[model samples]
Target: MKKLMLMLVSAAALTAHSAMAKDTLTISVYSFAQDAYKKALYDPFEEICDCELVIETGNSVERMAKIEANAADPVIDMAVISSHDALSLAQKGLIAPLDISKLSNHAKLYPAAQDPIGNNMAVGYTFYASSIVYRDDLVKIKSWGDLLGKDLAGQVSLPNITGTQGPLTLMMLDKALNGGSGDFSSVIAKIGEDADDIVTFYSRSSELAQLMNQEEVIAAPLGRFAWSRFKNSPLSFAWAEPEEGQAGGMNVMIMTKGNGNEELAYKLMDYWLSTEVQTRIAEALIDSPANKDVVVSDEVADNLTYGADLINSLNILSPAEIIANRDAWVEQWNAEVIK
Candidate 1:
């Protein structure tokens, strides 16, 4: 009878353990600085929630495709993607409107970050300034037009039209060339004209960093979030204060529609946006906080997209504009620039 009791007790314990293991939340995020994120945000939240976090990291295109492919049954409970990408998903009805009540930290974010894409479909997590990164000793970057100039010929890298930095670069170049028209046909044609002199149109900031480090690329347009890599390199690099000003945007978080893990997803998102977590992330120089409450050291601030002044100064592109125009931009790019 005692032996039978022991077996039943063990079976119950195993069942409880299985139940705990079943509670997991999956999040899709950009593929960068996972180690820092794991330390600053993921592990702490996992401890608090007593659940496993399945992190799926990739570029926006790949993550978006997965969300769309699994729309009938969402594989990702939540995702951190470009605001425009989230808008695209929302338009497809692949993501659900966020329950703002569930996010305690929602009230603490920047006013602009609050309802960034509207309908509570997404929330901004980080803001980044995109501009030129160039070797100070090799070249002087005065304007967006420098990429097309003969001085930087065969030494400059441009972001591919599909990536986040691509359109921002085009915007700044457009501004520099023709006083900032949203239309980029003229800029595209100009880039195409100088395509032979360009090293390559990079899709990833990390790729641009690699090329720059190797001396294959003397200058490139990149986001400030990716600045730490170039800053720490042995080679001298400078972040240009371009005459057209820096273009910027925010990366946001969104919930996948029909993903039954809404509660856990909300808990994680709330934790990530909290002042404590935002400060930790900012101090680590991992991400620029969208939570206005986050405060970091001045040294840390220098490394990140910190300060309301700088954030306000950024010439941000519209997420809605990007979503509406990306497909046409890609088509034109393939036909003109890539050709």
Candidate 2:
């Protein structure tokens, strides 16, 4: 009787361990705001799904390279990346089309978020407007053209051509100079012409913020997501409403091609897109909600890229356009601007 009872207990332990292993879900995401995300999104979703989230965090380029390296056997079940990066993955057949039927919150998303990168391969979870953030006390910025103007010349900084905001700044500057010409050769040459007057090409928003705070840079183009850094600063800063308008972009969520974890991944994605979670994230000021149903207070909205009017009014460069012309842009930037 003793031997039989011990055998039963051992088998039960093995079954419990197997269940725990099967319930785990792995994900990759940006390195920023992990603590805020845990409090707002990760912790709540973990409770609802009853699964452990094994998260991998890094820059989009590093994370995307990892996904590509492990394409034969995906380590990340799902990931959040810039829309252009998602499109690049979709083009490479590294990610699978989402089963929208499985997502209960699918209908809650803004139309632009629903099929951002077509074929349901990815869904946008956030949008951010890009514009110039200037020290209003020191100088006035009325146009994207002003960054290269003689007044702000030596005091202005621009994003590097390799960063996400790089192409956006280029697009807006092109609009300001030539009235929305898609070709950027002349734009690149123009920037090259004024490169000597420009302070430096910053790779991260934080670096630009630091430069501004020290009075080294008086004005620079930045994404709204980083507005809080300047908004709370002791220095007087202002967001620009340039004549060319605010340029914007979206970040998206994607499922790996064959991770064998769709059930749990879809569950988390649905919960994330739901109004409750989206509102929580927006309230935390971590990301602007892509779900149209999310409502936030005026104070909270001021810190985010919120509301239909502003979202609709943004001049967004398409993911297709970014991917198609990025190489040429970079090549010219190296030869002319950076040289």
Backbone-clash count (model 1): 1
TM-score of 2: 0.92
Q: After superposition, how far is residue 218 of candidate 2 from its true place, in Å?
A: 2.5
Candidates' C-alpha lDDT: 0.89, 0.91
> Against the hidden true structure, what lDDT does model 1 obtain?
0.89
The residue ranges of model 1 lying beyond 4 angstroms of the native Cα positions read 1-10, 13-16, 19-22
Candidate 2 ranges beyond 4 A from true positions: 1-16, 19-22
The deviation in Å at residue 185 for candidate 2 is 1.2
Each prediction's TM-score versus the true structure? 0.95, 0.92
Compute the lDDT for candidate 2: 0.91
**Residue-level lDDT tens digits of model 1 in 1-339:** 999999999999999988867588999987778898899999999888888999998777788899999889889999998888888889999999998999999999988888989999999889988889999998898999988999999999999887878888889999999898789989988998889999999987778888999999999998988888888899999999998888899999999888999999999989989999999998888899999988887888888887789899999889889888888888989999888
Q: Please give the lDDT score at residue 300 for candidate 1.
A: 88
Q: After superposition, how far is residue 56 of candidate 2 from its true place, in Å?
A: 2.6
